[model samples]
Target: MQLFYQNLLPEINYLDQDESKHCIKVLRKQQGDELDIIDGKGTFYKAKITDASAKKCRFEIISTTQERKVAFHRHLAIAPTKNMDKMEWLVEKATEMGIDEISFFQSFHSERKVIKIERLEKKAISAMKQSLKAKKPLLNEIIPYKQFLKETDVSNKLIAYVDFKNKIHMKNELSHQQDTLVLIGPEGDFTPEEVSLAIENRYKKVSLGNSRLRTETAALAAVHLMNLAME
Candidate 1:
């Protein structure tokens, strides 16, 4: 089923400007037409269009359903890559695979110091609609690496690091049915001091795999692993 997103649902029954245009002008939806809407907070609504205005198409709710609760929550924290396209790709794929939250941080070896959270959020919204997911992953702005390490609280905390002898795979480290957060470093990888600090904060050092992966790839891999653990 095709789904339109409008975070404000039962409270305010109208699509935003962009969504309104798509529903009316692009898709040619008319008054009395039925459509599915998601609030991006695990709620889905079945509604009938009341006004087909291209600027603010309004709808009346027919029914509402909440998304099924997952066995575990997956949160991925990573350093944004130097290339914006790569980061966008990561967000899109991770959303499709059912990530709960994504956090970005600036590390000592981070190549990209700044990121546009709004753009990434748009990508996530599109991916959620495409994948027929009712919930949208929370996209957080870039913060200091140390700050994230200190503030993050989850049942299972992991840091993807390059350590030949560490030998602990991320998949093996994850505990079933627990909220997990994995940290992926930047292109240049995390500094030793940063890894040490994360360990001090109770983040376990884990390896994604034998082969070295890019920052975005590592983050997606972590998300994928977390999803698998839930299954």
Candidate 2:
């Protein structure tokens, strides 16, 4: 089933401009037509369109229900790549693969320090609808690497780095049905000092694979492995 996103849902009673345009102009949806909507809060609704205008289309809710969250929450925090397109692609694929949350961090060797997460959020929303998922992954604003490391709280914390001595893989490290947070660094990779600090602060120093990966690749690998652990 095709799904649309309008988080406020029956309370707001309408799709925002972008969603309205797609529903009215692009998809040619009309008044009295039924559509599925997700609030990104795990609630899904069946609604009948009240007005199919090219902008600010309105809908009335027929039903609403919440989906069960995944057995485990997979949160990935990564340093943004210099080319923002790669980051965008990562968000799209991660959403399709079902991540619970994503974050950006500005590390010492980060090639890109800032990301326009609004665009990334849109990509995520589109992916969620395309995947027909009822839950939306949380997109976080970019924060200082050190600050993010300090403030993050989760059941499990791991840093996927280029460490040969620390040879444990992510799939082996992740526990079943537990909230897990994994950190992936930039292209130049996380500094040795930062790795030391993360290890000190209870972040496991783990490795993704034998071959090295790009920033986005490593992040996605971590997400994939964590999801695999529960299977």
Candidate 3:
């Protein structure tokens, strides 16, 4: 089914400006065409087009479907990389792979200082539609590492860091069906003090693998491994 996205639903006979433009101009869809719409909160609606204006396509809801809640809750808390494209790509792939939430942090050695959450939100919505997912992952803005560690709440906490000469793997540490949370460090990796603080706070130290990975790569890797553990 053809899918469209909107953050809020309009009550009257009006379509979202962007959805309308895509329906009328790009798709050239006509009145009475069937389409699917998602509110990005676990519900889907099948609608039939009523008006076909390029600026304002209108549709009537024909049927509705509700998706089940996620079986496993996974959150990836990471330090955004220096390249904006890499971060955006990570957001897209993570959403497509069914991530529950993503948060950015400013670590001791982080190269990026600021984040544009608005753009990231848009990218997430687009990925949701493209992947035909009913729920979109939550995107959080840049936060300080210490503040994030103190304020975030999750049942299972893990830090993906390799000590100077120590080697351990994340796949060996995770348990199934847990509310998993993982911290991925910056390009320079987390400082010894940061790692020590996390350990003191009950965060388990785990490694994705022996090979070194970029910040984004580690984030995505953690996400995939977490989902695998649940399955």
Candidate 4:
């Protein structure tokens, strides 16, 4: 079943303009038609259209369901790519693979130090609905790499770096069913000094594989490893 995403639902019995357009004009949903909507906070809702104008389709909530959280939660913190399309693709695929949180960091060698958080969020929402996932991953605004490492804390902390010195594979380092945070660096990869700082800040150095991957590819690999460990 196709699902619609709206952060807040049926508060005043309406969908926002974008969703309304899709429901009315695009899908041709009309009054008394039923559809599923997700609030992106773990709830799936059943609603029936009350008014089906192309600009403001209104609905009445018939029922609500709280989706169960997975035993494992995956949080990925990576440097944003210089190309927005790559980053957007990463967000889409990672969400479909079942990630819980995403953060963008600007590393010392980061080619791109900024990102459009709103645009990233929109893609994530679309992915969540397309994947039929009730829980939405939390996407953080871009922040400095060191700052993010210093501030964030979780049970398991890992950094994917290709210095070839650490030799610890991310797949080997992962502990099943636990909250894991993996950091994927920028295009040129994290500087030796930055990697050292991450180690100093309690992040265990790990590697994805011997085959060198792109920024987005490495991030998606880490995310996949995270999900695979749980399975």
The model with the greatest TM-score is 1
What is candidate 2's lDDT per residue for 104-207, written digit by digit as tens?
99999998888998999989998998988888899999999989988988878999876766688887888667899999988888899999989888988888
TM-score between candidate 2 and the true structure: 0.95
Write down the RMSD of all candidates, one decimal each: 0.9, 1.3, 1.9, 1.4
Off by over 4 Å in 1: none
Measured with C-alpha atoms, the lDDT of residue 109 in candidate 3 is 95
Give the per-residue lDDT of model 1 (tens digit) for 8-75.
77789899999999899999999999999999999999999999999999999999999998887789
- List pairs with backbone clashes in candidate 3: none
Instruction: Name the regions of candidate 4 deviating beyond 4 angstroms.
Output: 10-12
Write candidate 3's Cα lDDT for 49-125 as tens digits: 89888888888888889866777778999888899889899999999887989999999999998989988898999
Task: Provide the lowest-lDDT 10-residue window in model 2.
Answer: 161-170
Determine the backbone clash count of candidate 4: 0
Return the candidate ranking by TM-score, descending: 1, 2, 4, 3
Clashes of 3: 0
Q: Residue 80 of candidate 4: its Cα lDDT?
A: 86
Q: List the candidates' TM-scores in order.
A: 0.97, 0.95, 0.92, 0.95
Which ranking of candidates, highest lDDT first?
1, 2, 4, 3
Q: After superposition, how far is residue 29 of candidate 1 from its true place, in Å?
A: 1.1
